[model samples]
Target: MGKIIRWISWLSIDVVLGAVAGMLFFSKLFHVALPWQPYVLLGMAVWCIYNLDHLLDAQKVGEKLSGRRQFHHQARVPVLIVIGILGLLGLVGGFWWFGWGLELQWTFLLGGLIGGIRFLVLKFGKGWMKEFSIALFYVIGISWLPFLRSNSLDWSAWHGLFFLLYLLLANLNLLILSFLDQEEDQLAGFFSVSQELNTVSLILWIKYLMYGLLILLILVLVIIPSFYKLFVAILFLMTLCHWYVFNMDGVDSEKKRIGMEWAFFLPVLLIFLK
Candidate 1:
């Protein structure tokens, strides 16, 4: 039981769940009839490996706590290699399942490589790598390519608004997670926005920024008639809940982080239901 729990924690199961929800959102939005089973399995496998970047960082934290250097520094190399290979396989497999052309597959592969390089730099480079990693995961990996593939380069007011809103919400979510990691990140020498700015001021700014974005989304929905309003609402509520959880100051940080991540599925759910 202990081992199982540890494995689950190590795998960042909540993040995997959120990613699945994102995939489902895409499928529903596109009305794709592809078998979800393969996508789910492949997505989970790919995300699990992608998460090793964080797990490796956490391992370093553990090493700090134990005060004994146990795992070799070279251990992360194998994990990165495995992640790269599996990411390629998952990209090709997903595109194949969707009957998308080789072009889409190549795009995904290239994006994955770029994202992977960012991860590697974060792992080995200097200040704020972790925060940079979070941004890359959303802005580059999740929002940009997916939107480009789905909506194409057709420039329209509604599509542009949607893209902006998506990015705002995603960045807000990333900011909240960074806030939650304030302590651990400070200890780890990770210079996130939370660390760079005054903590209290940063939190306040983020809270209001997120709220403003949500309101803008709702207004856009009213004008443009998009179901994404519901999705944004759900995400906003979850962010509020996350703030509550953070302020409670009783629950463990890890638990709170995991819970917030799990709650991230609400946006995905909304996107799919639309």
Candidate 2:
């Protein structure tokens, strides 16, 4: 049972579910068939690989310093290998189906390479590199969606802005989890923003950041007025669910379980309501 729980935690199931919800929301918002459902699944696989990198690094650090393993030894290596292979396959399959051409594929490949390098660097790099890498991972990963959505290599400001907002929300979710892992991270010599700032200040900052982003989203809705009241209400309920998870302490297992399940359902709700 403990091992099962650990596996679920390492998978970051809530994050994957949230990504699925976001993708579905985008599909509805744009009225695009998003023939890229496979890509979204692939994106989740990539996320699993990226997360495995973190888990491996954490375990390595813990073992070296304390002479005791931190993360589950039996599961760590196998999960990492499996997820890495799946991520690679996902990338290839994504390119093949999406027909984004070599240039765009290369761009996406570069982002994945950066993420891999960042994983290694976090094991050895210092100060700004670590901080910069964390932010970069979020930017690159979220931007991959809009980039993949494009029919050509050419970029547009509208898509770029949307990607940026998506990345902001992604980082917001990550920061919340980082807060929960603050002690473990500090012990592993990881210098996350949550660790650098005071706890209360960190929480306050995250709250304001989320609030500001939501307000901006509202402004966008006002300007476009594309969605209906029901759509807005559904979005609001989704945000409320996320906020509930964000406020929960210590990565509560029950909350994680329930939140993961509900996150997926939000997109389904949008599909029906819209």
Candidate 3:
């Protein structure tokens, strides 16, 4: 069971599920009726991005590849073949599933552009950039469809607030992972936000991020409509889970990573609520 969970997390199946849950949460919140295509495409895109990132990292580090990266390294060829097939399918299916309205076209274009940039950053860039870029793109990928479908086109302040809160939540998760994997990353000679700060400083930053996320979640809960309050509540719980996982003594980083990834799936509960 543990190996299964680790493999699921390693392949980023958990992340894809979490992304779909988030997309559905927003779609329901905004009263938009989304087809199945968006969900499928989003899942494929997320899995590809994450696996590619892992594969890239795995290729770079020789003996220092972490457990997840090492798995990716061992299965590199199969993973690459699958990613290529999915990418091609997603491209063709996207065009078929979402007709070429200018809005849809622009949406795909922007997403592809950001994804390209993120891939480049992973290959050449180091430090906080990779973490920040991944967080930004993840939020955008999950929320953009629902936002586009929303009745309001004015880009209301509340919409901005909601996405901001989510982005922060995503960033916090990445930071915690980076902190947990700091030792392995250093062994692999990989740079991340953790590498830029001392242990004390990184812990301090994580604490600050959690506090800020807590307050922001509460503020959004208060100001957003009752319809959207549940989403904020879900985020609040996710934040608490992160705090718990990060502070868990005697637990390894891989377990912490799994815990945090599971937290993101809380949004799936919204489906039952509806």
Candidate 4:
């Protein structure tokens, strides 16, 4: 189980689920069938960038030569090679997906810029800035792909609502990951929101996030009847996540992260329902 989880993490398959979900949002809401290129672009960008983050972690873990650190260092060359290949693929896919269009190119560029900013902030900035940047970029990465091909720049109420809910979900996901990395972040002199908050305060914030999601679920219940099943599944999974955070998987950060990634798969329930 641990090996499987670790493989998924190392391969960054978790982020693929995110990319897929993002595409699904656009497809389901806008009735736009995004091509495979966008999915590949988003998935590979995430896979490349996430491993880069881990490589940085290995470096920052410092001098102790823990197993992870050793593995990261040893795998550095291969990871860099993979990133290069993925970047090349992204360039090709961008052309195929967007053509000579300016709007889509700009959107794609903006998403990359957001990812770059988050990378810089994670390296140098502290506290809520990094977390917010991460969540924002994540939303941009997946959402913009769908938006690029939209008939208009303006999103409808359904689009807006879905974006906000997904933003909160991404934010919550990053917070949990940040909480786990708080200690390492401290050692590396990086500030994280989790580092600043007391445990009780963090718990309160977590509760607020969970409640906010619940409220969204309730809204879906009353308002977005078509998405009622999808949101309900999200709510249930999120509640279980909140429970697992304090009581079950806090100690196993990798496993916790894996679980979070897998949660993205819940949206597939909509497919089955249909």
Task: Order the numbered candidates by lDDT, best leading.
Answer: 3, 4, 2, 1
**Tens digits of per-residue lDDT for model 4 on 1-274?**
7787677766677777766776665565555677666676778877887878778877776545434455667787898798889889877777776786985668767866876887788677767777778777777667775676676745567677677777787778777777766666666665689667866776678778877786766767576656445655554575466546535633676666677777776665555653
**In each prediction, how many residue pairs overlap at the backbone (N, C-alpha, C within less than 3 A)?**
0, 0, 0, 1
Candidate 2 residue-wise lDDT, 1-274, digit = tens: 7566455545655456555566666555444455655546645664675567656665657444321134434456776777777777776766766579774567678866986887687676653355556655655553455455655544445445555565555556556656665666677766666556667876786798678777766776576435444445454455566677876678764445446335434755776666
Comparing 2 and 4 on lDDT, the stronger one: 4
lDDT of 1 by residue, 1-274 (tens): 6455445545556667666665555444433433555446546564655566555665666556311112323345665676777767775676666557664666568667877877676566544454555544553443333444553544446544544554565566677667766766678766466656667876886778667875775576577555445545654566566556656667765566566666656656554556
Over 10-102, each residue of candidate 3 has an lDDT whose tens digit, in order, gives 999999998998898778766788999899999998999889988988899844557888898899999999999999998888788777887
Among these predicted structures, which one has the highest lDDT? Answer: 3
TM-score of each candidate structure, all chains considered together: 0.69, 0.68, 0.92, 0.84
Q: For candidate 4, what is the total of clashing residue pairs? A: 1
Judging by TM-score against the true structure, name the best candidate.
3
Comparing 2 and 4 by TM-score, which wins? 4
Model 1 Cα shift for residue 66 (angstroms) = 11
Off by over 4 Å in 1: 1-9, 30-34, 45-49, 59-62, 65-101, 116-133, 143-156, 226-229, 247-249, 268-274
Better of 1 and 2 by lDDT: 2
The worst-scoring run of ten residues by lDDT in candidate 1 lies at: 65-74
